[model samples]
Target: MTFLWRISETNADGLIGTYSRSNGLDRFELRRGKRIEVNEAMPTVRFDGRTRDLLAFDCLSNTAAPLVSQRMAQALRDSCAQDVQLVPARIEAADGVLDGWSLLNATATVRAINHRKSVYTMVPGTQAIMSFRHLEYLEGCLGEHQLARDAEYLGHLLVSDSLAQALSDFAGASFERPEEAYYETMSRRWNSANDAR
Candidate 1:
């Protein structure tokens, strides 16, 4: 499936890219009762991983939303029967730019009924978030290898200056320095919730 990146004015800066699943459907054609043409040239990223694939995109929110991270953590925890713990994760970016960024990582064993573990890492950017995730099933799973490769590819993209430049170029806006305090507060809340569980 091909993913299209479109710019929307949902944020104050009005330059945010949203990733959506495209089925090559044309709104105009459907309205006019015309034959829809499929354009295969659209940029598409194939995910080949053992588990669900993680996609990256710039959200329109002013700051990183805690609900997004919380939901992700909850999903990972729910996937396994054992209690899953999510703590601050250290990210060693090849470019070293992510050294000061807040990262969250978690891993949990699959339910007793299944064999394997689920792993996920999230890197929140000023206006975007990149997640690397995979499930280690017995005998391996389809898309696990692809997920790893995509995570690496996306990790580089997150730390690269070109990503910001591309966003600026496309949105006609500048990247705002992320509010570290906000993210820290969110992290504390998440950790506190984990502790209470």
Candidate 2:
């Protein structure tokens, strides 16, 4: 009963930290579990002009780095200390430096995709997956994890049911039901077919 984040552009109300100035930090490095070196432990970043204020747990625009409030970070530490890395980070708004926040880097990845049971498409000619028509996890693949990433589905950060329940009350959190899948390509194909009509 694991869960994954389902961020939406329509939900955010204000801009969020872009980490634009942080040289070593990026989405790829964090998600890939790469060790990043920063001159200062707490790198400063300002809210970008896009949309969304800091939430208890949130990812930046285009779904970049995962950021969490102190409260949420504590919950993550208590639950999945080995599965994650919470790097010290600072967020700035018009007022000043935001305290009690951290960058979440998921360190544990597993081969959790039950490919035989999951419905997905490969990128036209590439080996990469393009979209999922449905998604399912492999039996017994999660082990004893509070948080994790599926090596077969790199786009998401999955949380064990216990951890998901613990953070259920956090405002602006976006834990999705495990049954959901990212199927953007399916939508586009439908739209293009309609356009031809």
Candidate 3:
């Protein structure tokens, strides 16, 4: 999807050129919704401020096709000398065990615990409070699991490098799993409850 970035506003000193800055005072009063169409080429870079930074008078539109990520990497490299790499992945199936939230909740709980204990060592006096706060972010996942009683769940899908690493490491950690049948039933009930809404 193409993202359009229109100029909102700029510094009063005119360091950055925006829509209003480009226009000059004219004799004829230009009311709102006045048809200001361009018959010829428009002014490009107007260096008004001390910094002499190039600013535009009007909005610029750009279009792109599907090879967006590749183009983005090339643009970044062109702008700066930095190495860019991308990793892609796909899930073949859900394994027919856990519904979405069942697996996600388990994963998030494990992660929050590890983060609270290993990554960030909170003082015992504050550990309980911090842990609760951290767990709150995972509420959606927990609620989802509670709703999807018995369906097999699979997620923690890898979208980015950092997320993939976090999920893989989190999965390596352990948690107490209920008996298979009980877990399935609970998951189904929870999923049904949520779906009703």
Candidate 4:
């Protein structure tokens, strides 16, 4: 299925939530403890027959390109500190906006909708702030497998000063100290996924 990387925000109570997606009405809720954590990973998709149809949207698809939505693209913009043009690398777009984009990675899921999405760019200037994997899909779109790969990739990206700055800009707050609480959540998800594997 199609997937993207994302960063999400939660209310104080951490119940009601929103994600980045093309669909305007897709608001998601997190369980008791399912907030996005720093240096963590989560799945983007599951390979169930019910969702096999979603594979049609995979960026690697040889048929008609998938249709990414404007709503989701807007979410990516909101997640960033400022909008900059993404470079062409693993990313493929003629001149369209970040609105209708999806990733070709194998770890995407089509479960809950995701919001606040953006195409990952390895540009020198932007990379100094945020080190994104292939792309950023926010909210709730991935399943389990995709989450792990994303976390692994994101953790590596965080090692850079620029990535830190980019995350700060996207979150609109300073993340000076590492997120201890987020680490715990990430550890659990990783261990669980590893054990299952």
Candidate 5:
């Protein structure tokens, strides 16, 4: 089974309803693909009305960092413990503090993108990747692994087929393979171009 996709989720209003990183979050440290030093205040997430009884898997609205329920975190740990760091995080809701959540921090990066087949570039002297017009992975670049991130785009999460299947039942969580996203992106652009006619 050769399936790959990034885990992305949005609420009914097209926003990441239940999950957002605190303003004080050190996003860079999470991107380093290593265990984060838990500060006095570990990484945290804020929840609002939309989160009531919602599924436990979520991603930070702006950064796309994953936040998972304890069960989801444990699933990852059992499958690919070496590829991820289950950093503790708090889920603060209006009524009270909800517990048993972890930030699914990726710790493995593979430069699996076949540059010639992919259209993307890194900003000068920075890790930020822009112009991801196309993406194509090289054969065998991603070996057997449950979760491996993209080297070019630190925020991008690539999950194996098994992992995707394991998380399939989670409500509000969505995953898309590269080609699926690419086709959708291109189709939208094409429709827009034609609509301008």
Candidate 6:
């Protein structure tokens, strides 16, 4: 299966934003004040042996560096507020050099909106702003052992040196902001991928 990851960046008052994509539709939201921005994407894919939906989120907030870090940790805890236990896990970047980041693993039966079992990871980034990436793969995609393997793979990709370099270039560029650059990059990548098809 093909995994197409969409990217977005936002800069606004209160520093809250959301980006959601499902079934070829995309929605974005932003709010003001001390709030947590939840960016969710539900992409369906065939993994393991069955078709499944993967729910992903990138939660970010803007504040003093210290507060941002604090909020990031708190947000991670809040994500698994239900009957779920989070275990500290190691995620190595493919190209090495994973600075100021940590990953947490958990498996839970989410019963609030839908009754489904899921395996998820909470990745907190302690950069200029506090940011957290939450990724959940439905039960079928990951069994007991697969969870660790998949999580590690994802972690490595997230912290890869190549990814870091690209992001750094995006940040240093005078393209208004990283979010705009990210959108453009994703759009270009998507267009190229579709063109080849």
| Predicted model with the maximum TM-score | 5
lDDT of 5: 0.65
TM-score of each predicted structure versus truth: 0.20, 0.77, 0.15, 0.20, 0.80, 0.20
Name the runs in model 3 displaced over 4 angstroms: 1-10, 14-31, 50-197
**CA lDDT scores, all candidates in order:** 0.26, 0.67, 0.22, 0.27, 0.65, 0.25
Instruction: State the lDDT of candidate 1 residue by residue for 1-197, as single tens digits.
Output: 11112223333342222222253432222222112344442312122211111212122221111111333444434442132223321222222211111112211111110123434344555433343233222232212111111122221101113333433433212333223323545678889999999
lDDT of 4 by residue, 41-146 (tens): 2212112222223222222221111122233234433443132111111222222222233321122223331213432335475533254222333443333332
lDDT of model 2 at residue 33?
Answer: 49
Local lDDT at 80 for model 2: 74
Which regions of candidate 5 are displaced past 4 Å? 1-25, 53-64, 121-128
lDDT of 6: 0.25
Model 3 RMSD in Å is: 24.3
What total of clashing residue pairs does each candidate reach?
A: 6, 3, 20, 31, 0, 1
- Which pairs of residues clash in candidate 5, taking residues 3 or more apart in a chain or in different chains? none
Q: Supply the TM-score for candidate 6.
A: 0.20
| Candidate 5 per-residue lDDT over residues 1-197, each given as its tens digit | 33454445344343343444464667666666666666666665665633464443444342436667777777778888888887777666655665677777777777777778777667889766775777777766668667777776666677777778887776545677676677778889999999999
Tens digit per residue, CA lDDT, model 6, 1-197: 11111122432222322221333321111111112223332222111211111012222222111111223334434532331122211112222321222122222211111113322233455222122232223323322221122232321111112222323322111112223434555678889999999
User: Model 5, 30: alpha-carbon shift in Å?
Assistant: 1.8
